[model samples]
Target: MSKKVIELDALEQINLDAAGIDIGAESIYVAVPPGRDTESVKEFPTFTADLQRTAEWLKKCKISTVAMESTGVLWVPIYEILEHHGFEVFLVNTYHLKNVQGRKTDVLDCQWIQQLHTYGLLKASFRPPEEIVEIRGYVRHRDTLVKYRSAHIQHMQKALNLMNLKLVNVLSDITGVTGMKIIRAIIDGERDPYVLANFRNKLCKKDEEEIAKSLEGYYRPEQVFVLKQSVEQYDFYEKQIQEVDQQLESLYKKYDPPDEDNYKNRKKHKPRKNQAHFDLGDSLYRMAGVDLTKIDGVDALIAQKVLSEIGTDMSKWPTVKHFTSWLKLCPNNKVTGGKVIQTGTQKTKNRATTALRIAAFSLSHNNKSALGSFYRRIKARNGPSEAITATAHKIAKIIYFMLRDKTDYYDLGENYYQEKFREILIKKLHKQAANFGYYLEPYNMAIPLVS
Candidate 1:
């Protein structure tokens, strides 16, 4: 007897007006529905004029929406141009387009994307407003510049080490005011350790005698040349970073501030280890409409990074859970046969996640903050990695609430979280006892127990 085969159900099309484009470095292959008085697939050069023409062709075809894989920075220009042309462009991640598996080519890929989008199977990645996008670009470029400056500092340290100088040992920051002055003097042929030590400021914590001892090194001419060049490059990058900071401040001021006079009565917070060149704390608070720097372990620099990753608009994420998931901070649970299999957070290169993790690491040094207490508690049970992820997750939730509600984060205190955690443990114990047909009562530690 012949076996009967069951056919798969067809997906209903929800977006009949959708189009798709397969983006490449030099060309883009766009696909629209067949028999729409337009070629089903057409290849266009990856140029501004070509992109404009493609947008115009889509408009002529009455296409209202488009979906394309985020191949690279190549998609950015087309995305913006299509957006300008009033097309609802969906920038889907490459991973999300793997549902239709088979022999893949340029034409096939574009056709597949068009079909999937027509059935409403594609999800667009979160993108901020155009203004925020511009600000993000500036913020990221500044971060790169700072990294370059740090590399130059390392080069200076290497040069100093070659000369047997222990400046890094005595001075916490070798690029600080006093250290730079001493280094400059050394380059100018001041070889006396006492003279270099005299350049130290009274505010510096290191004693003059120790600094003098540390400054005494076998100064070779080549190493001195290297050090001078390193310092000059570092200074150049510093000026560039300052210009970027000025741009950031100007752009941030364009946002509507919650209170025009709030800056007048604002108390200056403690400076960060590497604070921005501008008044980032006040500017971030005004732009975010909340004082994010008030959160435990968050400083002005961290707040700026967070705001750059995700703008002040919280509506981009529907809920806090969605935001955390997008950051890859939440656990991905796999279940089979109604049994749990695996639960672990998916790794991601998200900047917000990295910034939150850095903040979580800083929390380990603060023993009194609520987040610090929570981190210690989790660390005791799950070790350091889990503790960091948990703490970062908590921070992501706190940020979400602050941005969504336009409210400041009020510290609840470590004791409050601990007390609530104790209550939860007691409730779990009671539930377990009742499952075994027994009753459990709250234990009073203040009262003596009678046998």
Candidate 2:
């Protein structure tokens, strides 16, 4: 028996002036609609001049929208150029563009993207506004510097360990004031344990005698040299990080100055160890038009990092659900034959999602906040991993609404959440009892216990 072939209606063209580009490290293949020009598809070298010519060619073909696969950093220059030329540039995800199965080549990919985009079958990936992008760059670089500095810190620790120094045992952080001073004194040829211990800060929990005991180590020249070099690298990265902070401060100046009264009235928070030196809370509040730090477990640093990643413009997401879905915090339920086969959140490298997760994790130890209670309740039902995602989802929704509606966060207390949860449990119990041909009555504690 011969199989019947199904002939579906052709997809209607929705973007008449759409074009597609397959960008590569050395060259790019561009495809315009058929009959737009004598040569509908053309290849261009990946040079600034050639990119300009590519834009000019697209203009010649009357293309006003362009779709391109996000092929690493290769697409950034072209995307910026096309956007600058006033074309609606869609930086399409590779996954979306890979659904169509056929012979694959750069030329074929460009044409396929063009065909899909022309029919409005493509979605542009979310990219924050240019101002946010600038802040993101600086913030990311600072994070990198911090990571690099951490490695040098480990190096210093290793050198200390080789020489039998036990500073890490007594101090919370080797980069702290007392630790740094002792380390500098060691690098400066001070071998006397008593002299090194004298550098201890007044706030140090360890007394001079205890610090001196820890400082008693063999003064190996080789280990001392490594410690010196590691400290130098650490200081260098510190300087670089400070420079980036200054740049960020200057960038924040471009935005509207924050309200002085509001800034002064805001609650002061103890700065994190690696937090930027500037008034990050004020700058972030000014940019976002709301103090995200007002939310529990979301400090100014986390707020700054998240805002830099996602920007303050919530219109890009149509709703709070859409925002969380974009962050990949919501579960992607896979159903087969009306049965759920899988339900898990998609793995994503979104920085905003990471920041939200960090904020959620911080709430694990907070007992006073309603969100903390919710997190603990979820953790009791599911495992810790699921609890983190669930709490992050809640936080993401709160952030979305706060930013979208321009409203302040007013956290209901932990007791309130607990009472509401108790009420819900009572209602569930009553319904279950009714289903079992019984009714629930309030438990009485007024009666005295029998002896």
Candidate 3:
């Protein structure tokens, strides 16, 4: 009798070929691989009950790997459900699994991912680790709430401006203390914007005086009602932002220095000399370092935005160019027979690039910074835009090394290759000077006079 042996072909690490799940908001399309006995693909709904049923159903099939495209946040729930159920699940990128135009259909999208996956042809994007994923959700939702609040604030501004309430003219913030009090009084049937502006606290006396001058906009009770709704929405978002910040504060401890609070007393006392220097990820301030702030012109916020979006996972990128290329930074190359078509990448208008631009602009005014030198260095050849990108590209490389190597940043010095270039220049100049019979000395010699 032959001993029983388990035969496997479709299984790779992470269950690469069991089935394919394509997710939409309300529905999910699952594609079971072609079986020896079946001809058409398997189809199913992906409801909670249906998902539980799928576990029992898939066990009956001989699928060894499960693959799916990450459609949206919708894909996440199902992916977790399926992965939790022990199916090999792949969260593939839509870019990597592009289908031929005519052959594309929703159901076929799942089928395509399955087909590519079965043949082991699927490539996936870099997903952050589980900790990063969880942290990302919190950070992303906070961003959405912030944007929502901004929209509400803008609507209120438009409403007030429409009413001709010079409240904005008098005060920088219509939602500010003096402005809010006057707006509320107006909504409550206060006639005089003057009387309303006077509703200031002791701290708001100066603000009140200025707001009174600008409280001259047109007033309608109906418009005031509309403004109230928008103000409420703004308040709701503010609350949400606060809650998220609390969560972030708790999570930040992992990256913050153990003695962060000690910084207050750092001027009076020093850390133990035996202690090691810290990495950038050690604090929000330190992490700001990777954001190219040392390059000058890069703001803390922009630097933080870059780190927040991509995390410190430079290993996903082999080089700094690869990282920027992923960001659509350099240029998009569409070619036929190696002839170029589009010269530059589509304008992404990403925060990271904005930070880089800030750095570039700063260089224009900053003569002491290496970023300033780099800007001048490249501006002579490529112009401001390219020079900024070149500087940004350099910053990205610096960021990668800082994050991946877990090292402190050291400036390359404004004259990074100055000694080498000087040596070469001296040799060339001396060769000519020698022919002319005039003795020459190397320009870089610290003591020019021979002692």
Best by TM-score: 2
lDDT (tens digit, per residue) of candidate 1 on 279-352: 78778877888888778888888888888889988998888999999999999999997777999999898888
Put down candidate 2 lDDT per residue, 288-315, tens digits, no spaces: 8777888888998888889999999999
Between candidates 2 and 3, name the one with more favorable TM-score: 2
**How do the candidates rank by TM-score, highest first?**
2, 1, 3
Q: What tens-digit string does per-residue lDDT give for candidate 3 at 173-287?
A: 6666666777678767887656876786566535655666667667776778888898889888888877776675556556635345533322211232111123222344433
RMSD of 2: 3.3
What TM-score do all the candidates reach, one by one? 0.93, 0.95, 0.67
- Which segments of model 1 are wrong by more than 4 Å? 1-9, 260-268, 434-451
Q: Which stretch of 10 consecutive residues in model 3 shows the poorest summed lDDT?
A: 267-276
Instruction: Give lDDT: candidate 2, residue 227.
Output: 98
Tell me how far the alpha carbon of residue 373 in candidate 3 is from the true structure, in angstroms, after superposition.
Answer: 5.9
> Who wins the lDDT comparison?
2
Better of 1 and 3 by TM-score: 1
Global lDDT scores for all candidate models: 0.89, 0.90, 0.64
Worst 10 contiguous positions by lDDT, candidate 2: 261-270
